[model samples]
Target: MPSSVPKTLTDWWCDASTEYAFLGFSYEVTACQSRDQLHREFADIRQNFNSRYVRLYGFCDRKGFYDDIVDAAWANTLGVHALIWFGFDGDDLWKGRRDVLLGALHSNPRAKFVTRVLQFGSEPLYDNVLPHDQLTQQVIKAKANLSDLHIPVTVSELAYGFQERGGAQDLLDAIDSINIHMLPFFAQDASTSAQAWPLVQRDLQWFIDHGNGKKMYFDENGWPSVTSSSVQPNSPNAVADVPNEQGYFNLLDQHCTDLKNVVAGGVGWFAHIYSDNQEPGYGIYDSKGRLKITLAPRTSC
Candidate 1:
């Protein structure tokens, strides 16, 4: 058993050692999802995959949606990486979403314990949801507003968005650390995860070169299991199927150490999704919540 206990949210994040990579799944909590479903899913995540973290993607529109999520996560002994989602419109939408998240956080005392990180927006820069400077200001303000909770606040964006977008450095300097989304499936490279490993490494190197030495986390990374006509792969060489999805995790298990060594603070990532019920093709489980691919046993070296 561990002797040290984490008092603050940042402490919880820091508790994971640089020598080992922590595993997690990105789950979207929809208003229509039942409480029983949430409990069952989180239980399956903990009991089956032995994952300790969950990166949540959703807004607080319906009452008790977030509370149920936190409760279920706490019951399963999983840490929550909560996201405050932003739409394509502007600050009004952003603020409304922010306020809703703040309300949820303030109302639930357990939120401080269960939530390890509070991500401000997902892909705000890539989608041009807000001006870079304005987004930076909001992040700074959020960090200040939630300082009492002691949770690390950051924004999620594509890995290259930080380098391509103007004023990214200012935003980077404002946040606690960098949260990047890297999906090799979208690249014009080889098909299978084995073929995509080189591109993954190249993306990691890009971060190492330009990330300003901040602690980096891949908030989203996984291969899609299937694709529709509208969701075709960028490369004809690429394929979307269950075998490739399994190969991605297999590669992660085999090269987990190299992934950790990409930065000084060590890197952590969450599998793109938990179930296809949330998003088509990206899930380890199918839409019916049945396991489609057997996850490789997590290995350190």
Candidate 2:
């Protein structure tokens, strides 16, 4: 683990080694969730997974929720990759979300120490919630406003979304680093978990080829353990089962070193979620908080 705090995106990218690539999980903070629950989850992330960071998703509708999140993460010595989510809502909603995040950071001194990055929105362009230019402008404005915080500002999007927006250079140049969501399960060629790494590698290479020299991180990546009834698979071979879920982790464990070398500026990824409670069948832990599969520590590999 790194002993020092990284104040800039370049510092984080240059300092990370293959052995200790920033490992973490993506978490959702629901409204009205208690601080005790937040603390417990963050503690599990820090102590059990030995994670150094967490990518937080979802909105902060409840008052002082961001404060609670930052406090909980800091207490467990974990850095926060804060996300200002923009759903199907209008511009006003997302702007409000951004303001709430900024307010929390300004009010809490500890947030400075705990916040590693601020992602303006997750997949807003892909989801059609905001057009490319509008999202780009928002990111640029947020980046300017957060200049004093010294925290890198970015927008999380699918790899293809950036590609579709003609490389999104204007947006890319405005931000510090690239945060992408690359899930093999959703790909047209999706197959068994044993075969998912190749898809992951291919998508990762696509990003590296067009990444504009920016350090890239996988904001969401993992294989689901079971198929949710409400969801449909993109490929006939994209079956989800317990064995395949375990196989995916096994493959990930085997390729940790390879991932570090293949991607420029090293590689860091948050498993899609912390538990099945966040997204059905995507968690290493079940909804009941029980271990669903054997997750070998990244360092062990």
lDDT of 2 at 14: 27
CA shift at 31, candidate 1, in angstroms? 4.7
Model 2 residue 77 distance off true place after TM-score fit, in angstroms: 0.3
CA-only RMSD, every prediction? 2.9, 3.2
- Tens-digit lDDT string for candidate 1 (64-119): 78788878887888888888888556656657768877777777877877777789
Once superposed on the true structure, which residue ranges of model 2 sit more than 4 Å away at CA? 1-22, 89-91
Clashing residue pairs in candidate 2 (N, C-alpha, C atoms within 3 angstroms)? none
The Cα local distance difference test for each model comes to 0.77, 0.77
Residue-wise lDDT of candidate 2 within 1-301, one digit each (tens)?
A: 2355444444443243442344788887754468998899889889888887889877768889988998788789888889888865565687777898988887787787788889976787677777788788888887788788777788888877877777776777777777878677878898888988888888778777866666777777677877877556799989788788778767777777776675454677777778788778888789898988876547533
Output the TM-score of candidate 2: 0.90
The alpha-carbon lDDT assigned to residue 32 of candidate 1 equals 49
> What is the lDDT, from 0 to 100, of the residue 6 in candidate 2?
48
TM-score for all predictions? 0.90, 0.90
